[model samples]
Target: MKNSRGSLVRPHPLPGSASRPVVTPLSPSVVYASDTPDALDDQYEGRVFGYTYSREGHPNGDVVAARLDEMEGASGGIVTGSGMSAVSAVLLGLLKQGDHVLGGNQLYGRSLRMMAEDLPRLGIDTSLADPCDVDAMRAAIRPETKMILVEVVSNPTLRVADIAGIAALAKESGALLVIDNTFTTPRAFRPFDHGADIVIHSVTKLLAGHSDVMLGYAVARDPALNDRLRVFGVTAGLTASPFDCWLAERGMLSFDLRFDRSQETAARLADHLAGLDGVKRVLYPMRADHPDHARAVQLLGDQGCNMVSFELTGGRASANAFTKAADGLSFAPTLGDVGTTLSHPASSSHRALTPDRRAALGISEGFFRVSVGLEDPDALLQIMTDAVAAARAAEG
Candidate 1:
C-alpha cells in the first residue's frame, strides 16, 4: 500500500470502514468477541485492538492524528483536550527539572503565563524575547535552554517570525524549535518546511472553523518526540474525546476553501480599515506597511491568514461603540469562526497581563482583533464602515 511517491498510504476501506456514517460515534471500548484468546492477546500486545481504553487511543482519534501529521509534514502527532493542553504536553513531556526555555514575548497571554508562572514553580526557568528580532532571541538563549517556544504569528498584532532563521539558530544551539502554528493553519504555513522540530495547532480555531470543538494538536518531526508526547497525553489524561476529534476532522475537510475565502476578505478589510477615519493602525501581515511584510512574504508567500487587528483613535470608548453598533458581527473572545467576529484583547485574551505588559506588546485599550470569516467582502466592509462612523460620533 504505497503511493507513487513511495509513501505508505493507508488502505482504502480506510481502517475505520468507508460505508459507515460520516459522523462516528464515541467508541468507549471495542470487544473482539469473534477473536480467540490467543488472537486477542496478540492484538492487545501489538496495539491493534482498536479500543482497549479511550484515553490511550481510539479509531476516531487515530484518523484525525494521521491526517494532521500528514498535513503538518510531521512524523506523528497527538490530539489534546484543548490548545493549552497541547502546549502543556509538549513543554512538560520534553523538558525536565532545571531545564531552561526561551519563549517569545508575543505569545498568546495564557501561553506566556504558563511559561512565566507555571514553569518556574516546577523548577524550570523561562525567558521571553521578541522573536521578530533574531538577535534578541539568540542573546536570550542559554546552554540550559532545551527549547525555544514561539508563535508563528504574534497574537493581536500579527507579527511574523523568521522561522527558518530561528530554526537554524535552535539547531546550532542544540535546542528544539517549537512553533505554535495556531494563527496560520497548515494550509498557509507548514513549519516543518522551515526546519521546525515541532508544530502546535489549536483545532478550536481555524482547523475546526466553527469554533465548536475544543481541541489541540502537537506534531513532531522526530518520531521519538511524538512517542513521548503520546505517552504524556495518556498519563496526564489530556487526550481529546473521540467525538470532538471526529467533529474537528469534519471541520477540517473544508479548511482550504474556508481559509481561502476568509483570507481574501481579510485582505480587502485590512485595506478598507486603513482608509477609515477612526482607525489609527491596521496590522495584517499582507499589508505592505506591516513591519514584517517582507518576512511574511518569505515565509507565507501570498497566503495571509484571516486575522486582522486594528487600533482605534478614540481608545476603549471607540472600541466599545464600534463593537456595540456593528451589525452582522458578533462579539466573541475567540477567532477563526465561520462568521466574522471581534475580540477586545484588553478584556479577553491579553487581560491577564499587567497594563504595562499589554502596552509593551502594543495591545492598547483601543486595539480590536477581527477574525474574518466566509462572508461577502463588500457587505462586511459596509458594516464595519458604519460601525466606525458610529464610534466616531460617540467620541464627539
Candidate 2:
C-alpha cells in the first residue's frame, strides 16, 4: 500500500539473516545486520573525503555505492534518499540556475515535472523532447544545454531511448548525457559503457529488490564529475539511511540473477498480453512495432529489463477495470519489487500532469505499466488474463 508517506514494503524471507542482532532506534550508532565489519576503524576519527556523517557517507552506503559502481563500471558513485534526489542532486551540482536541461518527453511523471515545474523555479531552463529524436536533440542544443537527460527505459510506457545516439549528440554538442537506469538497473544495462556521462538509479525499486527500502544513486564514469556530484550530495543533505543502504547491499548480490529471471518472465507476460484480445498496443522492448525497439536491442542487448507496458482497447474505462481485476497484484504505484506490481499511468504515476499534457506525451488513459517479478509466469499470466476479461465484461 502507498500513501503520500511513501510505499509500505511487503515482507518476504530475507536471505542470510538468522541470528542477526537488532539495533534499537535509541542510539546514535546503529547496526542493521551482522557479518559486516564496523564502518570506521575509529568512529570519531576525522577523515577527509571519507564518511564524516551518515548524511555524507555511511559504511553500508559506501559499500553499496562501491558495489554499484563496479556493477555499472563507473569510476565513482553516490547514493541518495530516493531516485529523484539522485537526479536533483546531480543536476543541481553540475548546473547552476541559468543552465539548461534537455530532458526526455516521455520521462517518469515526477521526472518530467521536475524539469517542467521544479527546475524552472530554481531559475533553470529546460526543454522536453524525444531523446531518441536525434535531429531534434541536435537542434535543441544551446550553449547553455548542460545536460541531456534520458531514461534507459521509460516508466509506464516502456519507451526505450537510444542511449548511444543521445550520448553521441551530447558529446557533439559538448553537453553531458545523463541516463536514468532505474528501469535498466546495472544487472541488465550498463549505461556508462555506452558513452553515458552519468547513470542514475531509483534503487528503491529494483536495486533494493525486496522493496523494503527507499534509495537512489548517481554514478559517474569520470572522477571529476563524480567529485562535484558528491559535494552536492553531501551539502544538499540527500543521503540514504545506513540500514536502508545495508538492505540495498544485500539486494545487490542477486541483481543479475534476479533480473535475468524477471526479464524472461516479463517478455513472456508481454507476449501473452499482446496476443489476447481487448489489447490496443503492447510496449515491451524488442517488439518490432515499438518506436525504438531495434535501437533498444542494439544498446540494451538481450536483457530488455523487467518492465512491460501496453494499452487497453477500450481506453480509460477498460484500463480502470483491468487494474481493478488485478486484485492480487500491488496496484498502488512504485515498481521494482520481488512480486508482480501493476499501475495505470494516466491516473496514478502521471496524475500530476494535466490531462492534455499527459495526452500530449502519449500517456493515454488506456496505458498500463506492469513490472514482472519472481513469480510463476503461468500464474501471473492467468491473473492478468482475468483482468483483461474483467475489462471486456465491463466494456459490455
Candidate 3:
C-alpha cells in the first residue's frame, strides 16, 4: 500500500501475478470480422479495461515480466527500467530506516553504491564481506540485518559466491538472500534452485542479448514478497516501459544459443590468458585457481558464463591501451550483449565506488573485464590477443 495525500491505496495487480487476474484490455481493441458491423459481446472478446497508468502495469510489460517469472520458476517477478532500479525497488520495499543490508564485497559497483549511500540516507545501514570467505559472511550478520546481496558471478573480478552456504546463513538469520544473476544469467545459474529468495538482473546485458535495450527485473521465490513488491512498484512509480520489456522478450529467445557460443569463447580466453606472458591473473569463475572455482563448478554445473576478468602485466594504463587497441570488441560499460564489450571497472562500472573501496575490491588499473560476444571465436581471440600485444609493446 502507498501512503500519500491522506489514504493508503492498493496497487493495481498485473495478470499472471496470480493464477488469473481479470485483465480486461484498455477500452478493448476492436477485432472486426468481414460480416460484423458491431462489436461482439461474447466472453472471448478482449476487455476494454486496461492500465490507467503505465506505473500500474503496461500490457507488454506484464507479458515479459511473466515470461521472466516463468523462466525463473519464481512465484512472480517485476521488471524495471534498469538493473539498478530493480535493486532500488526491492531494497526500498523491504528495507527501512535502522535496517541493515549485508552485501558481498565483490558486488556490482552500482549495487554497492545503492546499498552504501542511497539506502543509508533512508536510515538503513550496509556492510560488505569477501564472498569467498563464508566465515567472514557469517560474522558480518547482525540483529538488524534484513538482506544479504550478492552477485552470482561477481563484477570486475569474477569471484563466485557460495550461494547454498550463504542462503543457509540468510535463512538462519531471518534475512532475505538476493542474488544478482546478470553475469551468470539463468543460462549459467539459477539462484532460486540454490536457495536464494530473490534473483536480480540487468537485462541490458545478457537477457536482452542485443545490448540495445536497458531493462532489469527482480524475481521472488516467496509469494508474499512478490505481491508486496508489485504493490510497492506500482505505488512508487518505478516501473519498466512496455517497449523495453518487449525488446527483452525478443532477446530471451536466443539466450541459450548465444551464451553457449560465448561461453566457449570465454573458456578459450580464460585458458589462453592464464598462460599468457603479460597476464598476472585471470579471474574467470570456472578457472581452477580462482578463489571460488570449486563452488562455481558445484553451483554452475556445466554452463559457466561469458564474462572473463584479467589483470594486465602493467597496471591501469596498459589495460586502457589494450582495450583501445581491440578491433572487434567494443569498450562499452556493460556485459552480456551479442557483441563483445570491454570495460575498465575502476573508471566505468564501479566509478561510484570510492577509490579506497575500489582498491579493496581489487578493481585495479590493470584489471579489465571482457564480455564475450557471438563473434567468431578465432576472430575474437585474435583481436584480444592483438590488444594485449599492443599494450605490452606500448608500455615497454
Candidate topping lDDT? 1
lDDT of 1 by residue, 1-396 (tens): 656555546323326655877565655453224246677677668855545567877787788888888888775699899999999999999999999999999898889899989999999999999999889999999999999999989998999987877898899999999999999988889988888889998889998989789999998889899989999999999978778888888998999899999999999999999999988999999999999999999999999999999988887788889998899799999999999999999989998889998898999988999999988899999999999888887787
lDDT of each: 0.89, 0.81, 0.81
Scored against the true structure, residue 292 in model 1 reaches a CA lDDT of 96
Query: Local error of candidate 1 at 145, Å?
Result: 0.3
User: Candidate 1, 100: how far from true, in Å?
Assistant: 0.5
RMSD (Å) per prediction: 7.7, 8.9, 9.2
Clashes of each: 0, 0, 6
Total clashes, candidate 3?
6
Clashes of 1: 0
lDDT of 3 by residue, 157-199 (tens): 8877877779889999999999988888887777888889898
Name every residue pair that clashes in candidate 2: none
Error of 1 at 301 (Å): 0.5
* Candidates arranged by TM-score, highest first: 1, 2, 3
Global Cα lDDT for candidate 2: 0.81
Tens digits of per-residue lDDT, candidate 2, 82-132, equal: 998998887888888899999988887788888888889999999988776
Model 1, residue 161: displacement in angstroms?
0.7
Residue 314 error, candidate 2, Å = 1.5
